[model samples]
Target: MKQTGAIVSVADVAWIIALWVNRSIHSSMKTLKWLLNLDFEQQMNETEKIKRAKQIAIIAGVFTAFVGVLLLLNYLQIKKSDPLNSLVLEKLVERLSSEPNNQQFVEEIRQVDLLMRKAYFTSLWQVRTGAYLMLLGAIVLVLSLRVYYGLRFAIDQPSADQIKEKKKRQLTQRWIGISGALVIILAIMSAFFTMNHLRSYEPEKMIVHSKAGDESIEQLEIVSIRTSETEIDTVIITESTDVEVKQPEVAITQQPEMVVFNEETVKINHNAFRGSWGNAVSSSTNLPTSWDGATGKNILWKTELPIHGYNSPVIWNEKLFLSSANTSKRVVYCYDRNSGKLLWEREVNNIQGSPATQPKTTEDTGLAAPTLTVDGEKVFAIFGNGDIIAFDLNGNRVWAINLGVPDNHYGHSSSLLTWEKKLFIQYDTHSGSKVMALSTETGKTIWETVRTNDVSWASPILAKVDGKFQLIMLANPNLSGYDINTGKQLWSVDCMSGEVGPSPVYGGGLVYATNEYARMVAVNPKTGEKVWEDNYYLPEVSSPAYHNRYIYIATTFAVVACFEAATGKFLWEFDAKNSFYSSPMIAEGKVWVFDTGGKAYIFESGSEPKLISSPELGEKVFATPVFADGRVYIRGVKHLYCIGVN
Candidate 1:
């Protein structure tokens, strides 16, 4: 009996020791699984893990294969160059160039060009987006695949066979990585290969006339300079204007890339805002003294504009440029100066940072109130939304930039000025005022100067005094002058008041700044001294025109006033039947003024205001009359009419 009890006690002790050893082994295995981040297997039963791993492996494999196929397709697409370039675009551009007066062909070309640009840019954006998605999908696929493979062999013992399987898995991963890297390389190369390289525009050799009555021929290149992200066809590169320039007291760093502009601005016959150089006068002495729009007498042509805008027209090298916009879209139009036929029109869009919605604007200053200005190369237009863009002479987009939504009570109606290779703008608002100069080559800012006034709807004019060019700006009560190249304020005088709308005119050794119900003052630009002051008839919108030795003023009221250029002595004053918004333009020794009722009052540019003819245009006219090539181009509510005897 004693021997049997001792044996039983020993057996019980052994059984307890065996249970403890088993529990300790399970605890150590759980700790190992947690440390290795294999906790999914620890949380799930054997059957559940097997089912989950199978689902994960199939889904990940299918997704990875699908992404790979997409990448391959995208790569093939990028390898193929733009179909638009080889298709009908080149022929269209050539045909339009030959038949420049064909309005229908011009419209067709515009439509096709818009479509081609949209398609090309969309594809580029797609390729960039797909690359990032492919990389992310590849990473997810590898991780899920590893988890699935480990779960499949969870119950197996470690041996030579398992080690061999691990090596094989690593080999498969290495091949996958290599394939991915190769695809990336091919895609990068294709992106470069598929860039847009449209046919460049080669302008005809220009004939330059010298002061000594000599003629010379010069060749210029208007080539295509491609940008990677949003590449356009070509650009007319000019780094500065042809005006006189002086360095500022403070230094400004210019971009390393600069281009030259061979401009002969002295022989100025072009028509921009205030006519040539904002002077509002032409040297031609053979203009038609008689025209009747109501009777269609001496009216050369009348073409209906697509949209109505308050902005005036600019003429350069027999091409007319202007901009018009409604709430939905903004567009620039180029017309044949002789035939009054539409040459081309391009909508301004795809500009980065452009507002999706336009700001609030009044009816007087509509969305496209600001006039377009053209250098011999590029034509620039700005809208009330502050979107400034330049188009080549052929109407292709060169560069675009947004000046942000202007804080103007009426609307942003500041006209553009192009000098040398630089573009100037007077950005005055109710909040603050600034004068900015942008590079015509890349639309980059060359210099900026801030002003201390607020809320002026007037435009800046470029003036030359003492052989140096200065930018004259009218803001609120102060008229200021700035250095064009350096954007430094030279001088300012408090000579204006009220809502200044009429742009300043510089002539007769003085700068003319005017406002309604305020004094129309002329000041010496060099000394900032008031040369003369006339309060008899101040114009609200009509900027004074200087011709010969007389100053012409057309007020919003039914008044026409003439003043002596040397003195502010009132030469003569007369009140017509209609109000005038269109400024008086001096051409061929005649004063041409269009009223709001669309009646043009032609008078003599002498000390005595002798009325030549008050012809009715039969429509409302607000834009200033543009004199080009011995013709008067006027913009009515819905028509652009050429009034001259051919």
Candidate 2:
């Protein structure tokens, strides 16, 4: 077992020795006074006094020797039972077994091990305060004894002057030692605080300005504009005060009008067809309304999905895969991406629990929230019940495993990620969450690490930092990184405070993460150190999408904010008419975001954004958009839209 607490450690032996030395000196002084005041002038010989002095010195020497040995033993015990080394050994065994041929893997493992040891060792200094208190108590006890004995025995002695002077000197030395020790202790604490603060650096300040001019800022007026196909009108009103202005009237002039014959006309424009959805504050790709026969729009064969699902489709080669579930059955469906035809469906009765009132209670509530991932040969999907199923490209079941029963207030929402031969998933719930890694070939557990706090809806992402790969998860109260091979926690930064939803995005050498009630944070992924944090509250379910050097975040309050990825700086904000749950997807230099009201808003994916188009599908949408082979597939509550050039 590791060290129980910081208190009562091996290094305390030095403190004990110092206390013993002080007590011995005081005892020696007391013994000398007793010997001198025993009528020694008339009855005692010179040799007797010399013998008593020698005895007192011998006693002090023996006491000091005993304290020195105790101190040595304590140090030896601490070295032998170091808990940091033991934990490192456990992690090293797992890493070696997973990647036996990696050249620098062993060295990287050693470095991580050393860092953990240092952290634990540094914690020991916090216990030093208790040791100092013990030393102080010992000093006080020694001084009290010395003062009482000196006054009691030397009341009528002729050499009292000499004894008093010696006492005074000892008192002065004691005060100096106490003061110096306190100063050293405080200095050590201050240095530790300063170093820790410097390591966690904050970014520079940001300034935002309002659109209205300074003269009109005091009485800021909001104008509402209504438009039709032929005309546009605007109206303005102020709540604080009202002012009336005169309107100019002009006489109408009569002009000759020409009569036109009605004819059917077809107008086609590439740029005019791109529309936007979700909260239209962010930018998206321009989707074509039609495409050519082989790879484009209206000419290709189309097919319908077997059942309703919120999960987006995954396409590989010409085949498409998706997961879905109904009241009595859970299934994996395979389809043809070009023809939109269902090829095969695999159904199973894997669910065994009753549904709760909340929409996110179980995987059966919706089989398709967690999208399926393909690693060329096999397709993988994770159910809310912790069921992980794998299927080959030809629709054959390869393997399956259930991690655990996820009992979250809102069911499991994490998607599965694969690295090499391992499948990683974050299973954070109310009943104690954990990040688990499994062998992809057999679905056997590799390693599992318990999360520090409860998690709700966030997913984990794999990120490479400083040439090392780490699996990062945004759990409640913190963003944690773990060794991808061994599931050992490498580093954790406490930046998120509320329910975390956004899957972490890694770009530009920094890992970006945000929580529903907390702010967005950027950190150096390798060291798990915070670079900057901005107090921007977003929705509980929306995830940030990154493109170039910008990040687009959609809040539940119907606002989409664009931010610079490396530094936590807000660039622009857009106001959509409805709240958002669907995440934004970036493609073709634009952002496509869908809202619950079935409106798709397309925006320019740059610093200065402009609205491209707005199209209404007249349905509710909860899933994000997916793009493949120049076609965008959006799943609505009642229909799946295939947008491309016609």
Candidate 3:
């Protein structure tokens, strides 16, 4: 099939050759008939034959010249502007990449691309058909010219002047033959050049290489280190430079022993941004009620992070994972869960097309606002610059790829989510919002679905509601649910607005979503119907948590509010002088909410607000706390502090 397509790539040339071959055979048959004395130049009407031959030659020559000129114009048109490789398309794609959120440009590119593609195939068709007509005209012109000249050159009586005329005719014939050979040679060369040029433009391959520039990954360098007698698993990092690389990639490194390692039982061990299923609730018990960072009360350990980030920490059984970044480097840090000692920190280098300079971002949503996800055997980290890297338990770099620099006002803060072997990425831009599922082991795209939602800062949630798993997402204008296995959107409630920073929560047989300036609504996950909605005490940055029959929200306006999950009734709100950014988490029937001033407000889970204790963790807090093995892991503004029964 490919070979056949290649032949058609130079369709005009192929058509000309085939038609000429047929004409040549016909001319040979006519010559054979004349040689057998079937027709002796029609000597009965000599003058008439000469006149008719002259007229035929003149008409054929004019027609052949016209088609020849037309074909030259067509060739120049193709050579000057290949529709697939048009400058217009290139510029449009470039603008679309930089301004991905611009719907106008996105639509324009898609429309123009469709037109150019139609023009491409149309030009190919015209080339084949027009070239065939031009060749036929040329052949007729040649045959008529032969008939006219042969009649004129005929000499019945042998004469010196006649002999001179014959010699002159022979010289003309020699020059014509040479010219014809040269024309054929040039046509053959042009055909092969064109065939080679159009090889990459396969007709079936549509949508010009992802909207983001081609990911060109030249090579990977894997490096490993060992502090103790564990496997020196190598984490591969790539160097992104001005050098050209193509397309996104995620390569996996096999384990040394290839053991069947699955952390199915350790999911609730603080695996994702919230918990195993994106709900900020844990089943662990005996959590500390109070702690003082300044006095070291109930503080298990404190480690100063190398750099600050807004992303929360994720924990496995014995290893805690977090990521941090600056303008020059994006690094993933792993620490020992027991001692809070830094086990290893590897700079994620060599991503094919990671942005050299960071995009303009608000301080609130720093470069590392998205928290890491540890799916049993391997841990994954994604930065605001659209760089996602995965590493094994022993710090071996599994795979990494740049999702292209996102187009966002506050930067891409949507964290990563994992369910089983599939990883979900919710990339919401102004007009280019979409969801993508990728293989956790290989980083290959499993499915991608374009969305019509507004720009969103909220991450996604994979929740089990109505005895079925669904991927829930919060974006402006809608709270949507999608099938976890496939990316098909199940249901959507168009009741959200503003920046929609808070991720949706599932509780009380409903999903709750809210924004700062918008209303909070609880929707039925199965039917997409709103069960209840409240207009007051909305959250800006902090995600809400559900405990028992109440929904707790920590707002930026110095308040931790609670309401009934089943109804829109407001239970109570804890007013304070400080604002809140960290989300609230539920553990052991207690609601733990943190303020920006590093104060923790613990409340008993009930209809009414019961403030149990207000603890202080010294430094400011932005990332939500993670609970693992009864200890609360808080990613403070400058340090990772563990609160437990110390």
Candidate 4:
């Protein structure tokens, strides 16, 4: 069957080539007759001129025939090896061999056979169009040759009037050639531009949910040790099963108590202090400001440190723990929160193939982008390479686990969150992305759910939907919900554009997620139904912070917008002088926003906007400021500032 089709295609191509050659021969004959009628040609012998014209016509015809044969052979080869034809033949054979009474099977086979035939014809049409183009070029070449020989004959023995007319015709041909070239060039460039534009336009879609119940849980032993210069090493080894409680009680009651003390009653004092980066879970409150210096009356001491990072300082008692990294080295530094003095600095080994950042992102952007989460007994830090390290409050190394590589083209920015005895850290990337839970004590896998697409800069947020705990992950084209215990996909809503960048904020029963291409969407966490979507116009990389009835979103374009959390309605937008990459922190009746240019802007968190202060430090800043102990900790490119009234 294939051989038969090949022979037919060759015959068709041969016919087309023959028709093109016939038309060219006729046009060339007319030109030859005109050359003979010229007065200049009267000087030449009539027989000689006729003989030359016949020879030229024969040569043109022979060359055209040769080209036609080549085209026929090429078409035959293409038809013989076509995949579409093979598929069509296979389907036809299957249909003929089927049972006579099986009407439905016959129809299915017939449809497949029809589609294959259509595809084969379409492929053949494309080849025919290419051949047509060649035929057109051949026709133009034959015409040009006749004109060249006719003009040469006239030029060799021509009248003065003939020479003048020939010059005019040559000038016209030059313009035609130039115009044709320009048209072809423009068509090629237009096609390239259209393809480039299409590649950049990505459609917004819902997040995909993965099936759960496939993960294999493992048990691992964990050991904690306290080493001192004078005393022997104090080691504590606990059994994996005995220590692994279903739920840790420490997480439930650790929420800080909300105090309703008046501004005047709060006392302000500062002194040198030291502590580890233990978990200091503060209670959730709607108070605009929680700091003692809200009235600008209480004066507290301030200090600065040398390293800068995006990780928020975890303060336990007096000492502060934070991580910092540049292109060359990554360091975890301990600082005295009160005196602003460096206590001890430990350098972590750099992992190979880590994401590289521009110079502007050096401070807060590095392999140590995620903030450390502590559980009082040990401080845990997640590196860009998915390495989680644990240390005691006194800077003693506990245990380290290297979770597989993450899928982040920009870098891993998801911070660690602890729920009872489980440490939840999401590792979503361009390749092999998954969200996994680990035992906080033993570092053993609890449950893991693989994701379909890459979530470059977004972080997972834990939310309770309809009284059931679920893991909400912002991924490519969708917002996913997973069962907290079993890692099962509950539901997913498509409401994302471009790369997911913002960590989803849960408030008023809705999950707010934003992307770099400036799409903000709110969806019900339980049902995965979109509440509303707003185009911010400006790119948003920072997560939205919710307080009271409003959610604050900071964009990299230096604009901060406050929207009603329920309806996604814009309340007010503020355009600061510096671009904002840091998430806004609401405290003490104010919204604290740190900019990339090292300026911190404090504004009233209400309908009527009021700027409190925009303090400039002489360096760039990337990390958001954390308000604690009557002061704000601001991390700049070169130094970490403890900002407060002097």
Best by TM-score: 3
lDDT of 2 at 350: 33
Instruction: Score candidate 1 by lDDT.
Output: 0.72
Superposed on all Cα atoms, the candidates' RMSDs to the truth, in angstroms, are: 22.0, 23.2, 18.0, 20.0
* lDDT score for candidate 4 against the true structure: 0.58
User: Backbone collision count in every prediction?
Assistant: 7, 24, 9, 16
Superposed by TM-score, candidate 3 places the C-alpha of residue 331 at a distance from the truth, in angstroms, of 0.8
Q: Predict model 2's lDDT versus the native.
A: 0.58
The alpha-carbon deviation from the true structure for residue 623 of candidate 4, after best TM-score superposition, in angstroms, is 0.3
Encode model 3's per-residue lDDT on 10-54: one tens digit a residue: 655644654565455455435433433446566436566667666
Runs of candidate 2 exceeding 4 Å displacement = 1-306, 350-367
TM-score of 2: 0.54
For candidate 2, what is the total of clashing residue pairs?
Answer: 24
Compared with the true structure, what per-residue lDDT tens digits does model 2 show for residues 1-646?
3352342443454555656665665666675666657576774565555555665555544443443344334334445554454555666646655655443554456566566556445434433433343344334434444544454455556477867987897798689657645644454444344234322222221122324332111122222222221121111111111111112122324453342211110001010001111111222245453333234334334444556766666555566677876545568887766667777676643322223322346532364566666655567787666667777666666666555567766566776666666777788888787776766665655565666667657767766677777888887787877778666677778888776766777767778788776788888877678998887656667777777888887777888788887787788888887877778766667777777776677777777667686566556777776665456666666555566655
Regions more than 4 Å wrong, model 3: 1-267
Top lDDT prediction, candidate number:
3
Mind giving the per-residue lDDT tens digits that candidate 4 earns over 328-392? 66677777877887776666543222334322233335677887765555566777766676665
Question: Which candidate, 1 or 3, has the higher lDDT?
Answer: 3
Given candidate 4, what's the lDDT at residue 445? 67
Candidates 1 and 3 compared by TM-score, better number? 3
